[model samples]
Target: MAEAFERGGQQAWFHDHGHWGVFFHTYDNFQLSGFGEHFDQPRKIHVFIPRDYEVSPDRYSVLYCNDGDDIFFGDGETEQSWQVAEKLSQLYLRDQLKKIIVVAICSGDRHYEYSHIPEDDGGLEEYSRYLAKGLKPFIDENYRTIPHSTVILGASRGGLAAFYTACKHPRQFPQVATLSPSFWLGLDSPSYSMSNLDKAFKIKLQNSALMFALTSTLLEPDLRPKIYLDWGLRDDPGNEYEIRSQCRCMEMIQVLTTEFDYQEDHNLFIVEDPNGSHSINSWGDRLPNILQLFFD
Candidate 1:
């Protein structure tokens, strides 16, 4: 496979031209790896271009998906996948959605890179920089995409990454979809060095609530990205982790509705599925609805 572009694009494979819409491209490294970086693994980017891309001169909207592994191919850890390319193709064929490009950015150290806890091995700052600064510029330069039409999306840890990235860089990602986000992770105290573990939990929740308030305040009221958040009621069933996560998710929803002043079914859309769980398949099942909510 030859390097596809000046920056580090290597074509993963070639398909019969104009037949399949999905294309795979790999980068040698996440761009700007030397600037206070820790995770610098090879990046695999899967792009889904609508079939009309070649036939029409029109530029399409872009959807920047995290967890590229779960998007088309399972991450090799499970037999589940989102098949996002196939879904977009179906929607395009049915004329139910406007043409859009899907840019799925695969994860490296998923837990570390997707985390917001800067005190931990969290590399979210670097990872989001790669998305908003590095990858977006590269994609825009290479593809016929609509300017400022990018939306970020993910599930689980990737969901946390997407939400944080959008909140921090709303201009780059003006819309976001977070499905079954691991909100429990954020609920825990970010500091491992804290002396009191019990008090840390309460303090963390209070601080997190305050952080959300600050998050809303920092984001210009007009520039706040449209947010789509969802979680399954039975995410982990009997697991305490899921219980905390669901509670935290609801709490964040409350903050967004009240503090952020987001109107339901308008700029803010949330879904609570009674039967939904924290699995790739569950997130996959909910993806089309998310796409419809944002892109349709």
Candidate 2:
């Protein structure tokens, strides 16, 4: 049910001199078969350890992300990545954040599993198991990672998956950051992805909020895990009347808080990039700050 694959020795599109000490390992969740027979490349996941890791080789926090191919690394030049490796490299050098391990789990037929739909593959627990259960243990064994200090992250569509991952498995990944989650994927009209987020946090917070921390499994009675939500307000090229309503998303979240009765101040944060748009550059510019607020 668990195996480690490798994309070793292949030409990398985003690997550059500045991305020093970066080592990658390929992984796949081939056992995860939702589409049945038609599914290919099932066990594909990537582990990205920073250059600093070799020198320190100490236990570090782990951040798991979706969109494995494009987030931490890219498939080709035109498919530019989020450049997180370099960004973290600079930050680590300047001491903006501590060194951490980033595990990117690729999404095969992501549209199905990344969604909440019951019938589709996105809810494919097989892939999730390979990461949260199988692959993660492998990472813990090989790399110097804090027993659990695992943080789950995702952007755009990946964002929604990150949140869902945290919500369902609060004990494993207590802290989560979603940068413009593609919540709109499974939602209906008059309600967007933001609506889904509203329900998740409001209804799902544990008592201790310390689930993601290495030492904690339960959020304190009044305690809650740090949650970060970032969204930009800009006219999406594809959607006309559907320009992302960042403000409305915030409003919906706030309303959910009141209705759900969770700690308003401690549970959630909605950061707005007022002048920002929807793009890697936009999300990248704010990644470090979000890390500080949530994972630091």
Candidate 3:
């Protein structure tokens, strides 16, 4: 209710406060925030501060996500936005779920940023820097964030970025959730569109190898984040790969888990939703669990 902040902050539910001064933040002087030569000017980042920040006098966990364009809405949400704010509010009513401040930093390059094909170094490292070095510090200084409980999440390429960032910089983010990641990225070739399906498969397979190889270092003893990944096998309407994505997802999960096992303390999970697909709606299903992972 009260159309929390702006439409982009659709899910934010202010506590019993009268809801007078909830401000929707934009890239106002984000450039002046002490970033060195290593940082790039962000297109824009929307910051949502819950109304209770002052009255409650408690530190709230921070949830950072990609694809802000459709994640929040007062109405007319594309049936996929997390609907997280709404769900959590209801849960908060029933029991003891902690409140949180969600920082939805959006981007249009869903594929270019999430996928490794176009990124200089799988796009994960730079993106991780943007968050750990730039965004995360800004939040810590400007807002009260639970340093150890902070989370990063996404779907599709955003999911890939979330997973990559957590693995690459475990100390920065202790929790992560990614749903229906288009692991198909870096693999989708122009040839796939040109009807050369076999060649496309080859390209994806090759890229997948490289991507996983890079993630191997993430599980090193010193850096390990609690990770959650889920996917739907029967997506794409009529997938012709026979035992394609499902089997592949399983295999990849196995790989990641094996690596995590080597670490002394790492919690990694893979939930397979039989009827899920690569979409926002699918990710929304895990909203409750995702929140509890860090907030609770």
Candidate 4:
């Protein structure tokens, strides 16, 4: 269990239990100049390249994950990461999942990068541009990847961005996983925090309507991504927000199944955690399930 450490502007580590290795590289400011002009600064990119990457010369599916820092480093207080590398190693060794490349794109100004509200300066469109145009090209050129099997994943606001990006560009990303998305973003009132308790029911209704409208208007059945969504019942302990979030998730599931006619446990899967909370740990706990659904 060798701990990861930064050296020479990169974080590198090898798992003693498996042959796979994880590397973190920094893309300097304006390095992606020609890719997209929306984001102007540098970004730390985490990549997990399997051991057989060089020996096999086989093309593998790619999972582009958002909130790279949280996924890799974990929260210092809890030491709970997505445990992506370790889990991928185990799954591959067991022949449960194929050897896939993971590209974890670190967040830069998440509030801006992951936002999806059309009226707000969410930078989501720009972020998608960076992924579809810049990052994807770089990875595909540098590593062997299966273009058709690519998947996009993220949690919370990042989840929102992942779904939005997939909807907008189905040809590039055909699979997606969203964990506890903040679908309540645009519906929030100016005094949302103060009135959250009283407005829980109202927020749920609003979120349902908004999700329906967004999905119905933007998503086409023929181009929909293989989607996975999950939310915790106790997401925000003692707060009504979690319930509202769950409601929103349910609404999205309803629309997907009924409107889009996506069959459950087929092209669409939804997991509801009865005792789960909204945190990296919760997401980590469910990562195995998601991987099985998407990659198994």
TM-score of each: 0.83, 0.72, 0.75, 0.82
Ranking by lDDT: 4, 1, 3, 2
Give residue 137's lDDT in candidate 4 (0 to 100): 78
Query: What is the number of residue pairs that collide in model 1?
Result: 0
- RMSD of each candidate? 4.5, 7.4, 5.8, 4.6
Native RMSD of candidate 4 (Å): 4.6
Candidate topping lDDT: 4
Model 4, residue 252: displacement in angstroms? Answer: 1.3
- The prediction achieving the highest TM-score against the true structure is 1
Q: Could you tell me how far off, in angstroms, the CA of residue 1 lies in candidate 4 after the best superposition? A: 14
lDDT of 2 by residue, 1-296 (tens): 22333333222222334465465555434343333453434456666777656577477888887777776656623376777787777787787787777887766676766765454444544444445665566667767888558888887667767766665556677778888765544333434354364553342222212122212222243333456777876655543222343543564365335644445447777777875676667777887887677557
lDDT of 1 by residue, 1-296 (tens): 33344433434432322334444444434444543545444666777766556678998789998988778767646757887767766776777788788887877778788877765667787787778877788788888988688799988788888888887778899899988777667566444323453453564442563255347533468888888888887735344444455666787787777766778898888898787877777777887778887777
Residue 273, candidate 4: how far off, in angstroms?
Answer: 1.7
TM-score of 1: 0.83
User: Per-residue CA lDDT of candidate 3, range 148-256, in tens?
Assistant: 7788888766777887777776788877887766565555532244245455455433236435645555546556677777777664644433224444455556566
Better of 3 and 4 by TM-score: 4
Alpha carbon deviation, residue 274, candidate 2 (Å):
1.5
Identify the runs in model 3 with alpha carbons over 4 angstroms from their true place: 1-39, 74-80, 118-122, 188-216, 235-247, 259-266
